[model samples]
Target chain A: MIQLNISDIQHFSVGDGPGIRTTVFLKGCNLRCPWCHNPETVSRDTVTLTYPKANKSVTYGRSMTVDEIVTEVMEDADFYRQSGGGVTLSGGEPLLQAEAVAKLSQALQGHGISVLLDTAGCVPWCRFEAVLPSVDTVFFDWKTSDPTIMRERIGGDLPLIKSNLARLLRTDKGIHVRIPLIPGVNTSEEALTAIAADLRETGAKTVALLPFHRLAVGKYEAMGIPYPYRDTPPLPADTLRRAAEILSPSFTVYAEK
Target chain B: MGCIENFITGMQPPWSDGRFDTPRFLEYVFNDGKGYFHPSAGLNTGTAESITSMEILMERLETQLRAGVKEYVESFNRINVLPDPENYTAPFLSLFCKDCIGRGLDINMGGAVYPSVHGAALMGVGTMCDSLAAVEQVVFTHKDATIAELVTALKENFVGYEDLRSKLLAAPKYGNNNDFADKYAVWFVDFLSEEFMKYKTPDGGGYYTAMAANVSNIYAGHVIGATPDGRRASEPLSDAASPTYGRDTRGATATVLSITKPDYTKVACGTVINQKYSPSMFEDGRRDKLRALIRVYFQKGGQEMQINATSTEVLKDAMDHPEKYPDLVVRVSGFSAIYVTLAREVQMDILARTQQE
Candidate 1:
């Protein structure tokens, strides 16, 4: 069966995972964050790749074997070693293609290469359960602890996300909670303290502070869609630093990549 | 003028198709009595008094260029501000070209204290020079009688000298690559730069100047007259004050080729050569061999490159097929031109290079 539906494969990225990682953007997403940069990934169905100059084209990927995927990735393995970066599996949600993610991660791991899985914890717990053994680290994105805000910004099933978090905590995998602190939206003093508290409760041990940015504005124009969070300003760098310092005492809060 | 009889004479096809031949060009330029004549003028000597920021240069250049380009478009717009100033020289050169081609104006370029023109030449003078310069020389050098007669002729407005004006306008100038001339031009510039850039500025601003001169995007050249060498009329040159094109070998080569110490140091010497083939050869994968040739160029101590990077069919199509992409900018050897605006033979050279496949 055609298992993996990838949106993009970006190279020479310095701030994705550990170092310079090749972040593979898989196509279908489960949650819809208002400030999402890769909004194209949110839909489960395949769509045309659109350009801002009024051009549109089809996506280019086929169902390849685990070995075929590994071969494509290893071409830049030397760059990974030099830069202390490896492969970061991110997407609509890598967990959406759980079996493929599991197989691909294990293949890369068997080759002694590092792998990172970036996810929004709303997927079925069994999906993460299958991929956990191979993934070196899981960047579990958790935007807000307040269930109402979570549902409003991104159509999130917060209780299920928290429960999935609880299950991951029970296991021996490394996990970090990624909270994007958007001012007037999610970046309140209360949200920081509350997220710090929820992360501590999850026993995740690390929470990364993700800041908002305007880099995704062009993508919205390209897709011919009005971005709901268009007017939302980026969380100032100083504020994130201050928030990181504020939340540090609770659970090793660090800035998100 | 005394060495006129002693210098060895060479045969030239007095009639030209007006494409790319140096001897015909030389014969046409030297036909009658001329107002300006200098065999050996020193290199890189001018009067820009070395002001350091691009801000001041832009303020002064913008005013003059607006006047030069007033007749072209009805009104100025925001896009005309041209954030990219480096590509402005050829356009400026085009303005002087249109003026010289439209009237008999023997305007001397590369003279006096206009820093903007010097700045433009430093960009890439090889492609853009001779065309308009030839026209200016044509008007000033005609069936004249005495020294006073020539001087008086120089003062006449382009409209008064209608016959010479039309002849001047009728001639096409160089900006496109012509092998024999571009090669010789390096020698002429080398001669001028060596002798001219010897002393410090009269203003104590050292004579050593390396500036990026394409200041505006108006496609304008500078107005020069009665230079030390003998530029007598309002010679139109580029006023777009920024830098030169194709990296000047010196700027591109990691080493900063400046006039700080020894002048006219050979940094990265590059020239536009003639290619006989057209686009059909390259489209069939001749570019691989061309790429390999460049690899050898770097290996054999050559560095840096910028390509016209389009196919000949497209070039031929652009010229013959002008209705297709009117805004196509192809490298006319050193300078670039919007393909539709280029003359036929210039378009043919581009077609030949695309054949390198």
Candidate 2:
């Protein structure tokens, strides 16, 4: 009877996780990062996006029981088994509906499918505890090291987020600390050093630096909202390499384009 | 266009009591006596109403196999003994000159080093497998319709059976690496090749089964009736050995896995597994992924694959204004052709091939 608000389920998602995974974008996020690519998933309510040029309209946000989600994700179980991929629960924040996510993850795990959770870790530690029992891997996002920027700009509690990430790192589960390399937000030498110092304290070993892209401009256009970073060009390859160099001394770095 | 049932019935020789003169029958059907006739093996299996019942399908296939073997033997026997070789022209006679000088016989008179091994092009492996899977799933597994109802539905060309046709279309298809459907394809190649291998040419050459059907699929589809795979009466029948166009919703990897399930060693005449990709897949960085995919396919015993790298947008534009892109060449089955020179239906068929991303 438990239903989770869903945004979209993307199959053959190679970039989300290790192999050919199906990323289940759960509707609703607590954080408001300005450069967030998935703007439509920020709100819990259903929203429709219409693109005039493509003559296509898409509606996001639906309520589906865990059984329905399990059945749909299980359709690609063979692909997952073949390519070492499974389901990736990503979202505004996947831990928002902790109980439902726990149930969905448990059901998927029962079918021998690996479940990975991609979260910003802004929620309370209890939410992570609720879903971690069934999740095989955790892609914990660490946005910025500055407390004021985390609070005012991104609407995240730095202390709470850092504590949750540290606790997740303590567990035996696989943890991949992802840093979205927003140019003005977190790509500075000072900011990279600070973020790496904080991550080192949290005992994180591997960090994936995701370069910022303007691909979400169309999403903003469809949603009828002006993207703040529309005029900003993507982070150049050299800048991404510099950021990776700054973090290499603290943790193993992978600069993902 | 007449259906195969009507064609077969009309091909019954008047002099004989319900017995077909296989040579004359093939001559009238394929070549009109101008060229040779290679029996299209398993082309009509999916369109036959007996596909709803496996017992009847097996029986029909057995009868067709016997008739096809007879035609092969008769054609080879007749070609082996030509009374006079002097009537042929110089260019035609020159091909057998070495044989005539060395063995004092013409090529057709068994003087050539190798006997003529006829190539029986097995058309519509995808169509046959999809149709069988649809029947097994809809009729046997789901019990959504009975064999009698399905036969009637096909007889009516699914006019009032849209719901049934949708169910059939929604069933598990062949190109998704699902064993439920791919097993039928495996059996199809094994059974047909094993049976054809038992027969030999007059001078002892084995029959080679080919999955390459040039542009003949369009013509073959014209004669087939509504198939259980939800294909209408006159739609092109699943070009070459590839799946029904647009049915492979899964990406390229699953398609490669599904197609390589059949043993290609038994198919000495080669297969044409057509795959299309966006032009970007042929670019510098992504081209390596495509190369790796083909490497895996060949490593898994795939005999041959044909890839088209033109984007659908360009193809659509070419269709709209043929003069704009005269040099757009594309691989069609076992051969390549100038895109604008092909018929519109063939163009549409090429455009319908699922572009793997």
Candidate 3:
């Protein structure tokens, strides 16, 4: 009888994980990253996206039972089998609904579908422990090593996030540390070096550096919020190369451009 | 024979995927066919000229087509009777210059030239551009080998070059929603459509183009050499309007985004955007996502979409057990037919289409 607040269920999502995954983006987040691409999933309350360019709007946030969620994600069961892909739970922070998501992941896994959890790792260790057994892989976001920027810009508790990542790393679950290379936010050499040191200590194997894209500019417009990165150009290819050079020594780094 | 005519007439490979060249074959359509000089020979016109003369000659070709069309119409009318089959249909493209005349001199956009069938469109630039990015990334950029070595390897059909081929294949492909390769596809569409737009049909109809090649990508691939996208020699080119089979690694959503990047509004003849989803994706709840995906695509100016819900399993079953699937109909390009009736290779080709969720 448990219910989860879901924003949207994207089928055949390749970006979230390996193969053809169905990414269920749950609503609400603890962080407030200014350049958060999926702003709609950030708020727990239902929000409508009005696009003046297309003269249309779309509302996010729907309540669905665990059975309904599992049924929806299971529709691509064949794709999951053929492509080695499965269900990925992504959101503003999937760990925020740790209990419900743990049940959801277990349900999906029960159907022989691999479950990947994509989260910011800002939640408590108990949340990670609850979902770790059900999730086949964890895409942990490592925004910045600096605590000041984390708290001021993104409203994240660096100590808490780091502790959760450290705890998750100790487990047998497959883990990938994702770095969103936001220029002027976390692309600095010093910051990347600090990140590399932390991830190296945590025994990180693979690191995916996601370059900043302006794709979410429209999302901000629809919500009537003035985006902070409106005038900011995308992270240049050279910057990505430089960042990769810094991160490569500790882990097998690749650019997700 | 039409290929030979295109060649004898100095037209470059004007067929789907610029593979056919001026024929070197000596076979003749008529007794006097061998006697006529190649169009290039006439362009020389016994004149020593450079840039200006070439420009002037280029301008004269259009005029020549207009004149020849005029003479053909006059002759056809004079010789035709009430019962003449030619008079009824007036098949426009069989005659030389009709394709160009229909676009340049003709006013109607009704007739279409042989456009780049989806898979063969990359042939426009040959293997150079498509493979150039990969070569740059794998060999040159990575310092894996020199350009000369890579060229030699390509000449050898990548024999003993398994590592290099894999690296090239790993390079971003056209339909993977990666801007690196998809940009070329966008340019291919825009360049061809824009070029055709310059010509008008005789009836003032605008020139239209198509990416739908039906099954010609298979035939076209037979003549093309190994390409840079790591496609082996004699491998089928991407079919219909879809990307090279299985090259769209990002699944259906990304493929849709990449395929819909071209301005279909400029293409009056329409294009076919093919997607194959497993049978399960067509089920009640999941079918709505496919519909929404298509709705999003069309809303973004996509002209046409051709989706096949038949899974590879069903297709393979149909192949092995034709008696069991008498009514199993599958869409092949613009039309649908009994699955059992199609050629095995074609059936296999449809079977290989990347089936998504």
Task: Output the number of the DockQ-best candidate.
Answer: 2
- Candidate 1 versus the native: TM-score? 0.43
Instruction: Note the Cα lDDT for every prediction shown.
Output: 0.48, 0.76, 0.66
Residue B158, model 3: lDDT of 81
List residue ranges in candidate 2 displaced over 4 A: A1-13, A17-118, A123-159, A162-257, B1-58, B61-114, B282-288
lDDT of 2 at B212: 64
TM-score of each: 0.43, 0.65, 0.48
Error of 2 at B190 (Å): 1.8
Candidate 1 per-residue C-alpha lDDT over A1-257 given as tens digits, one digit per residue, 9 for 90 to 100: 33577776665344566644667778788777777878777776655556746433445344566676686666556446644668999887889889888988998999878999999988778998899999888888888888888787678888888889978877777777787777766677887777777777777777777788877887776667887768777777788888887688876777753
TM-score of 3: 0.48
Please write out the lDDT profile of model 2 over residues B11-78, one tens digit for every residue.
Answer: 11111001111121211121222212223432233333234455655455555555665666566556
- lDDT by residue for model 2 over A157-254, one digit each (tens)? 99999999989989989999999999899999999999988998888988999999999999999999999999999898998999988989888898
Pick by lDDT: 1 or 2, better one: 2
DockQ of 2: 0.14
To one decimal place, how large is model 1's interface RMSD in Å? 15.9
Q: Write candidate 3's Cα lDDT for A1-257 as tens digits.
A: 99999999886775677766789999999999998999999999999999877655789999999999987676557556656678889988998999999999889878888999999988778888898888899989999989889889888898888778877788888888999999898899999999988887777888999999888898898899989998899999999999999988788997775
Cα lDDT of model 1 by residue, B1-357, tens digit: 110011111211011000111111121122221223322122121123221222332233333223222311212222223224353333333333324334432112211122111101232232233322332344333422232332333344333554444444333323222222233234333433332234222222112212122221112222222221122233322211111122122111111111111222332122222222333324433433344434433443333333566665577677766888878887554356787886664454345431222
Specify the highest-TM-score model's number.
2
